[model samples]
Target: MNIRFLAQSEYFNGLHLKDDIVLEKEYEQGPFTNLPKVRYFLYYLEENIRKEVMPYTDKVDIFNITDCQSESDYLYFIEYVDMLDRTYTFNIIRYNITDHTHTKIISLKDNLKLYPDNKQIKIFILDDSNLIIQRALPKVSENGKLKEFFDFSLILFNFVKNKQIIIEDENLTRNGIEFILPYSDNNCIMKTGYSLFQNNRHANLTKEEAAVESLFVVNISQFISDLQLEQPNLVMNAIDQSYYDTTVINAKLIENFLIYSKFNYENNDENIIFYDIETKEIYTCINKTTTGEYLLKNATVIEDTPYMIMKNSTGTQFFNLISNEIDATYPVEYNVRFVNNNTVISTIVEKNIFGKETEVVCIHKFPIKKVILQEKGEYIGCVTSDKETSYIFLK
Candidate 1:
């Protein structure tokens, strides 16, 4: 592993949280409070400049990019709307960085008649053709007052032709679905959460259970067929659940290898299971105080040997994906991002000459992994506000 200081790299400036930060800007007083809009506080490497793409208008109370990500040279932005009718709308915005001259907005409300009551929808874009979207479980009150939604719909959209399929599990109204591993070439894994999870074998146990983690392998082509044909039953394989730890909070799939973890947010401890999809073999996963969200990634594949980044209480380590073993450990308060075959990016905070802590973005040249080789090219970097899904490769 090698590190090179990327003085040319840009850092994130974050979102607009408060209104009074800029005293010169005036606003018309309104009775309703809206979620904070993107004030376009971003960092540029070449020159110091601020650019706002979608500015707030008179008719719009809030315009938020709930999520955005990059695939190849294109960027996809998910914009959410909060309406007065207690209905929600989603607009998919597509932008091309290579051309920069084209932008497209596809509104869900215009295509589909269904309107989600909850604006907080989770989405995962699998490819150019497929999208996995889930509606969250409504929060239950102390008195068990349940809110009404049309149904708990998990939609799989083949967005190319505006074709979509919805899978709703009515018996588990209180449960929420999350995207897990990619099961096959055309399928991925989905898990249930947000409430008590009852394992099938322990169904008769009159006591509480861990977060209900139901694993399902959903076929893409069959799912769309069922929905388009107006079939009554959805065709999906429901995998048997076992009492491993608690629930699978997050997962990452690499080819036939899958890392499933049951992460407890409060205590910072997680139980992991490594399952091989092709062989149907399960490996007991070990973690040294791994605490956080889905930060697990393919560390740096060397040659044909694959490796991944796993975490502990102190820092991270490079674990072999095939052998299921740890190799090296990285220190605390730093994150490693595999930009591509040409470059690797990591963020580290260092104390400057002014005795102030400063974030320094380090860039590493690739071909570090001899295992899987890719064509190398000249790469440029840009930073976006949404760290969770945002990627900037502006040619």
Candidate 2:
């Protein structure tokens, strides 16, 4: 079983009084002012034990008490341990003074030596607590002996202020080494060992190295936000026409636009609508399912056409056209049956005034299953199959 104990000591005039001891306030302020309160408290408790049953020995040894604080706050805990174990076992005792309390803990264990010669220890001091670990000697020393022996130096990569890695020596005679790690201006630190030349000392990259590194860390989300902000019109046009596929439009395009737009609409909403010509609709949904709604009013039909227009409620449309110059030699009934079965159905429209008759062709071979006609135009919504459920845009 694991066990822990805590003691509190209060000091009045300095004559530390244990929990069992009863003393008046006036007497505590006078004769007991200079006395060792902790020592007296321990002595009084030991005296109370029956000597015949248990014999006590003068083997108590107090080791070093270390106090440390953690990075978050300044509260501290002091830890004290006994270095001697012989004959009698000990435990912690609490003493109370007028205003404060002092505590001393005791334990029974084999005699243990701390900080032996040639022994190395790692001491982690935090705002509220500390941790000490005995470790083997490090290969490198503050005087750069490791480099001298190995004939190679260890250099820190991506050095930057506030995110520096430091190596310090325990003795004052040895100086410490500090290396700054690179971090973005936004206080975000990049992961180490990214760029071969930037993080590796042996790599010999040339002019393209800087450019490669810049592209590697460019925040895509932030870049897009800034670009849309600065060049609102350009971004709006791109979104309106689904121009994201262009290779020339990179992160820098959006980044510059965002920087420019920052002054005008700092708190504007970021959701956007994208329109694709192939799908012929304003895509609003992204991810999950590949489906979106199209406004029927946005559909257009060319005049003097040879196609029949159909619409649907889910924002889809289809155009049907007939071929005038048919191969009549196959027989009229056979040709009509072939036309009805093999005819293509689609929503795309192509105009050709040079043709003898208005020619309307379907871009897709799937049949139109649903249509919704509105006052403004006709919208072809859903298809006979799932193939027409296409084009998704994310905000």
Candidate 3:
């Protein structure tokens, strides 16, 4: 079995986790000699040996691992600031697994533009070819003050092909965007609305207080095609956001179904909405006392499957979108990561007598095994395991 080792000293037998959303951060200036260096290694479980993949360096400020596997070429992004000019430099590197060499695909210097005082920006590396960036642009007032209504822009830059597509709309400028997801292979769905952050005073706001107004599902490939034909207005004119006028959040697209959850203000409960994108048939569940859970933390659609695992204050249920039935109800302890028809991958917390909790990886089907780590870390490292091979990461 092939396994991707992130760090040394301790071995963690869990699937390597991959995050679709990546936020950029600033690092302290200097030599950073006292900091711990984290390196990447490729472990062959059958032979029980690891080969050095990427050595950690002090110059590189940020490292984003796009893809890493022994069977295929690994892709990663490294960003560092130029000390002389104080400019950010980003580079995409493609490493050949078999040959033990890497190639610099593209390097961008001083291209990242941010708001006043470098507020925050999100960088999404969809693949080695496509890179999406979302940043909040400033809206200056007449008195030269920043306004609350900030304009947002989504830029998709294909560094390999050297093509770019920018989407700047009034809707994004007005309401603002919460998150964006890869709809399928060629499309992406953007959710635009305001959010009421969870606090002790007001945990779950009612619908009248905070509600999502618009959700735009755009076909990136089709939009790009229309732009190529010099018909950019066609894609912009096709956007309709009048149907979903409710408090919707955590929207995910699986197959032909757009599954999401909404809050009921009257009963103070949470409800799940199953929307059929093809037939326009929406099926919403009855109100349940599953409110107060944080957004995006309680609900997730299983990757490469037709099921959505939803956790609430009540319990966790595996809802089948195709059959419109609850396949099985699991305890709230088991956090489902990835699932298919044959295999179920999840993590469960095991506590010892001293009240020390250790998260263990549980592989249910295909080949049942419980993988545990010797050293416990606070961060949730990468996880990816399938029928063929598994590559796990740990601190």
Candidate 4:
């Protein structure tokens, strides 16, 4: 088992530093000395443990910090600034590690047309250009006291074209820690499944009571201008509750189609469904082996591939629908890419610790399996995406 050593001593792990999101990334700025004034952390252990203190220089009240676990050396954060009046302004700041400088990339000022008194806000960066901002405001209770409830909304903004798509719904829920599981360039999908968020909040989730999940497909290019209203207008609907209370484990937009894998808690099984958005047709992949236990947190579909990649608990596995089999396993948690259905280039990163020494090596392994795709589905869904045209036949 891999264990992560905590950097928290009696120094920083206190109540005072408990409220902030406290985002950290694996970055080294000038030998960890003379670095910015931000809390640093080391995740996943290694040798040559180093520590240093430096003064943080950027002059901004950082509300939250966002870290992208990528090769980028820059750090992005969000801030709320006061502007003389009762209203406030939100800014997305990008800090460059090379020059020790910061830039306010996006400025969302207070406008009467938009929400002015947004109390809490969270920004998630899909890339250098695409981002989504979620904001929440308070709601007063009937007893003349604060109800501790905040209505939330999601706004998809593209910094490349300066286009913003607003998401407004009566039943909207969001988690502060938001991420994008990208399917393509402009297509992004977000889903909220069941249970009603336990007292209308993202924390403290309760089970036993099942709720149907709603899937929303948003194309950023559709709402860029006012003329694209007739372009499907963001199809939002709940999956048919014919079986049990299903929770969405992963969702995606593949070839303009919706492919999702969800676990049914009632039956203790998992099902992968494919729904075509344009044709309103659906298909399901029947698994011969029992799934739903030991799930992978990530669901990534490779380009020009028929199989969906899953980070299996034991190793990396390719879950193919046509073969109805999971084949070709690699080392667990290894950075791997597929050369074909049968072959994978595994970049194994391992740090070998021998007493007072540690040796890190990256080994490439080729594991091949001869697999083919099955065209016809094991089971085709009678469900329709177009609910208006869906007809119920009395049998």
Candidate 5:
């Protein structure tokens, strides 16, 4: 097997594969302006050539390009900080790849009344017309005591029609909707955290001591549908506690199942739980580990077979979502970075005799009977992987 090296850089942030071309972004802070400066380049692996693409030279505090549902158009944001009020403001810019034109969609200047003190912003692009923005900040108590509570607000904006709906939940102390992703082509599921004043699972703790972090799944398709219809203040009524437990902390929607980790606080161990959305039943894989946490990823094998990667302290486990079984496992020393139908790529960090650390790549061919090849370099992550070719970025 041949491992191809595309490009190496010092300011490498991320890499993406779109069709036959590879997109690379190098990010750095402007020395004078203190604003973020980004350089985008495209790599043609067949000819071993690289060309600089977009050069965003504008002076902005925080500039970002986000991909939405549209293939022809993308969304970018320009943020600035107000020193007098100590607040942040931003504008969303729509860039068309076909025409290369810029259009401002949502401006915080116009909606200052609605979004006044947005400390941290997270934007979610649902489709071509729908977008969700989450504004969150820590909620300070009356006596200025540091607490775990937070203030969260959601903005459902329809840029095409130039309409928006705002919803705020002030007392979302239980982590406040930590993650959101597409559940299906038309639906979305939110992994929300909440604290019940009582130990609902185990009644061994007092009320104040029962403030443990738990997770629940909420289907927000209705909110999306209502936002598209120009409805304001749409309610979220699909939160079901039967689908989760206190043991589950983090989750991700993979195909039809909500894959998450169920951690036992007392034993300090964790396991994988697959909750079927359709059947409302959960299948637990009892491979316990002392890692106490895990990262879940959705991966595809050759011929577009679905699989999930459960990374724990021991190693990475390749779980076959179709048959509900773990097919393979890699050691903890070898951090599995990417997986595809034909090959699995991992990175290993080693220290030299001088005590300096370096990362190298290990390539395993499917069904991974043995390590077919090993390449030495700073293999940070994979840009793209397929049946034949794989692209990775180096430090």
Candidate 6:
């Protein structure tokens, strides 16, 4: 039993059509006698009432009557002023009934009709349990044109929980979009499984090629020399040229050499000591020996006074001193004694030997006792004083 008003107006000549309109239960039998006469009376009453009431500009007055006998038989009347103060009559009917389900169906049909050709539709499917699946690219026509049909296929693979798949295509020439495929049916699909960039610019060298290139281009001797100059405390040595040339022909040999070199260089240098068995003095010497008498100038000798000869446990001849305790002359008779394990040798200068001036001479040697051997079964071994620490291996 509700009534709604809608705007519906028309113009004729220079006059409005609905300037005066009235509604009654029976237009032919009412006291007004006819619809036109009732309309004219409504126009006159509306003018007189408006002049008395003077309603507000923004508000409209609506009157309700509860004494009606039938809700469906109610009537409405409208009256307004014209430019020439003339009157006219018009008729209108109102109804209230709506079907929401029918409206929804019509809307769906209209939306589907908008894309009849299916130009850019895409579809995706997933497998139930297997890791194998097929992917179909967009179908192309014989003339190299893409089909208007949708593009997609089923994906089958074991699902990884709590992980997401991301697809990325940077070139605008290709479709660039990302979507999440839920882990359903115990499987998941990845749009971009493999990386587009697999081949790299750097070429992998073979064993032989690597060895030769590393030896020729790396300048290992220069590297060792630089390390020696920069860090004198580090015990570093380059493999002999013959060894390098032989190993350079094979890449495996170079890798093995690098591995061995790294292990040898990792320890504390102070733990390593160099000893001259022939001279019985602690001094740094090259591994290769030279024939002929070589005098060691600025040598760190044990005693203040010179001695005639020094000997190690191996009965090798060492150095000769030139001065004694009294006049700084070299000792020729007395033999020096070591305190522990033939390591330290010290001379005793008594008052009787030097006539009042007491002096003692001592020699200290390098302490590197054991070298690590990088071979099967054995892990360490000892190296003689004449051999380099790198050449020694555990056996």
Tens digit per residue, CA lDDT, model 5, 1-395: 34576556664444444443556566677432334555655666556667654354332434223343322234354534353464445666665433456676676642333333435566776667777776666554444433332566667788889888764443233345555655554555664554331223233333343333433444445556655554433355433332223445556644466676655555656556666677767655554566544534543443434466677887887777668888788888887777655688888888999999887788887556366777778776665533566766665
Which lDDT tens digits does candidate 2 get at residues 102-170?
Answer: 333323232223222222222222111112211322233243322111111111111112121222212
Best by lDDT: 5
Model 1, C-alpha of 330: deviation from truth (Å): 8.1
Off by over 4 Å in 6: 1-316, 320-395
Q: What TM-scores do the predictions have?
A: 0.51, 0.15, 0.55, 0.45, 0.63, 0.12
Task: Point to the candidate with the largest TM-score.
Answer: 5
Which is the winner by lDDT between candidate 3 and candidate 6? 3
| lDDT score for candidate 2 against the true structure | 0.21
User: Of the pair 5 and 6, which is ahead by lDDT?
Assistant: 5
Q: lDDT scores for all predictions?
A: 0.45, 0.21, 0.49, 0.42, 0.55, 0.22
* lDDT (tens digit, per residue) of candidate 4 on 25-79: 3333321122222444321113313322123422232233333222344556544
Pairs of residues at least 3 apart in sequence or in different chains that clash in candidate 5? 302-341
- The sequence of per-residue lDDT tens digits that candidate 6 reaches over residues 12-81 is 1111112222221211232221222122111111222211111221111111111111112222222222
List model 1 lDDT by residue over 123-242, tens digit each: 666555666566653443333434432135567666787777765444233345544444554666656544222223223222242235567665655654565554544455565352
**Which residue pairs overlap in candidate 4's backbone?**
37-56
All models, RMSD in angstroms: 9.9, 32.2, 8.0, 15.0, 7.0, 46.6
Q: How close is candidate 1 to the true structure, as a TM-score?
A: 0.51
User: Cα lDDT of model 6 overall?
Assistant: 0.22
